[model samples]
Target: MTKKNIILVVVAFLLLSVVASGCSKKDSTDAEVPAEQQVFEETAEDPDIAEEPVEIITGAPLEEPLAEPEVDEIEEEEPASEGSKAPEEQSTSLGDQPVPQEAPVQITELPVESQSAEPEKPSGPSIQLIKTNGETFYMSLDDMKDRSELHFSGSFYWLNSFGSTGHTDFKGVKLWTLLEAMEIVDSSSSRVKVIASDGYSMDFDISQIKRMDYIDETNQDVKLPIIIAWEENGEAYDPSEGAPFKLVVGQKEPGDINKPQWVSNIEKIIVE
Candidate 1:
């Protein structure tokens, strides 16, 4: 070979060696890194990657503080009440409201009697019956007790139809006793009048409840065995049930033409 040709061949051999060495180094470096690690490294260096620098503490480090849960903030509102009236022209907030005042009752001079009069009977229950004659009695309910003053009087159950034959025991004071006490001047007519609460009236004949002439020669018990009941079935008499006073008369015998005649609200007793 010529000297010039040999020199050119040597130069090409050195250039080829240099390129082969560089390729070998690159291959070794690529083989050392895993595909996943290579991708992570590239993304970490990229500007668009969502990465934030974390501060690292050296030595005996402190524990990371626990993050607090976020909560929504709420605002308090005041109540709008009737007593909190707003000023006429302005938007008055609750905080700017003025306290209300109560009106004072006016006091005027008046006669002493007018001020202290027994506050009038403001319309309620009042005694319905008026006293006419004989003896007037006022009984207090607050002091009533059992077996208290047995007053009995009655009339025929069917007055018009029975005449004296249809005569029945009525409600009122006992005829014999009342007559005996009133020192009755006359009982010859054998007539008695009983008034009821509903303004009902009935006439009673003494002959129907005639003096019982049984075993006892005098026969005082049978003659005046009448009852003035204030109650029935262990309870006070209802206003509609003829209570406060009721008269029940029982004759000596069941067939004695006197059974049961209920008369209530006895206003007066006339022995004629």
Candidate 2:
């Protein structure tokens, strides 16, 4: 045999010897560990398994659980004896004594002056007549009605300021008759004035009072009388339509606006 081949054989044999020794040592270490210790170490190292911590006992064990306490029974009250009275009866019992009662209260009435009363109605004269001689006379509706002989009933046509025309049936005394009755018409008394409650007034000549001349619907000369009226169409005037007295006159001519000469709610008549 050659020397180089002999040296290669020796080196290969030593390498095989070292490998065999390592495998034998690992087997011997695994065999020395317990099976449970091996399993615990494997479980700790595994990512999927969670390891349980060891619990060490440090003091005495807990005593047995305490028992619940027992409940006590309630005692019943004893009944009253037949010889003793009840509390309500003992408080109410009073022999041979009368009970007292409270007295009633009295109320006072209010005086008659303190009570409310109805308001009195207003009173005023119906009409007043003043003469040029400074003689004044106040009259009422009853006084005027007493002179029934001078009353006249007629129908007349009239024209108002608005160009409206109307015909009314009137019952009243004539202006001339009223004037003559009061001796108001005289030669020196050239004019007469009629006034309303609202302060409206109109003046008239004595000639007009004696004769109120007008042209009829046919445009012919006709003479009509002026009157102080209290009723129209046989009915007394309403308060809204010039109550008590109204001055009315027929149209002076066919187209004369005669309403301006008329007066409503006549309160005064003066002859001057």
Candidate 3:
């Protein structure tokens, strides 16, 4: 044969061998990859296919969660019914003595001014009445008697808010008598309010009179004597001197013996 014809034959054989190799590979793949495996691979490659996630639990069935202990529910208490009886008040007794019930006190307001009508202007030194026992009395020096010409003569000083009166002597009508004349007693549901003509006033406890310091004169230590003094230094109190009448307490002093409980220009005293 000619060399060109030989070369052409060799090239043809090489092409045929390549074609045979491809056919053999196809047949082997079809036989080895079953239809199921081929379908699975196709489905895995498809974008529309969704695969469920698998959880890898490597432990024994989790010990069944321990049962929770039962808890007792607390019940709420109901309010007392309207018809239920109220508990009786407890009382204390001393020895075998019977316990006493507290006495009812009559209601009263202080400064007694509110309990009465407007007062008439005083033509002279006067005392306006404020009675807790439903009684009233108005009086001037003419109507009041000096039950005691209380003489506070000594080196006694009168300390007051404005200024101090040096050791001086004071003469005045006894206040206890005045209170007695008005029927004030410890049991009365009232306190004493001394009001000045100019509206200045102070309260005096009626119970103070029962105190030894007030009843015992030697008790110079006694709560200083309180008074409705019309005179000081033997002279009547002129307007310049807290005139007409002035309510004062204390006999001597030093230490917060401060400002006398003196409400000057005495006009009225109310018991309330």
Top model number, lDDT: 2
Mark the regions of model 3 whose C-alpha exceeds 4 Å error after superposition: 1-123, 145-155, 160-165, 212-224, 239-243, 251-254
lDDT rank order: 2, 3, 1
| Candidates' RMSD to native | 20.3, 26.3, 23.4
lDDT of 3 at 118: 48
lDDT of 3 by residue, 1-272 (tens): 99999999999999999999999999998978755566567667875652643344533355788899999887886876878744344344556555556777997667765666544746765677667764656667645434444433322355556654445556665566566655754465457788777787787666653332332223345454566676667777775544477665653334335345667778767777
lDDT of 2 by residue, 1-272 (tens): 79999999999999999999999999999988876676678777885763565343534466989888876776775777866745442343357444444465877778989865433322533667778987776656665677887777777777888988777788888878887886766778888899998899999887877885654554355556898888888888775555489898886656878878778899888989
Instruction: Summarize candidate 1's per-residue lDDT along 1-272 as a digit string, tens digits.
Output: 99999999999999999999999999999988876566667767886762754343434456899989888777666766778866555555588875555567998989887663322321321112222334333333232232235354323222222544443343434445544443442434456665665776666676643443311112334444544445554455555543366655544443443433656655444544
Q: Model 1 TM-score? A: 0.31
**Structural similarity to truth (TM-score) of each candidate:** 0.31, 0.50, 0.44
lDDT of each: 0.50, 0.75, 0.61
Q: In angstroms, give how far residue 36 of model 1 lies from its true place.
A: 99
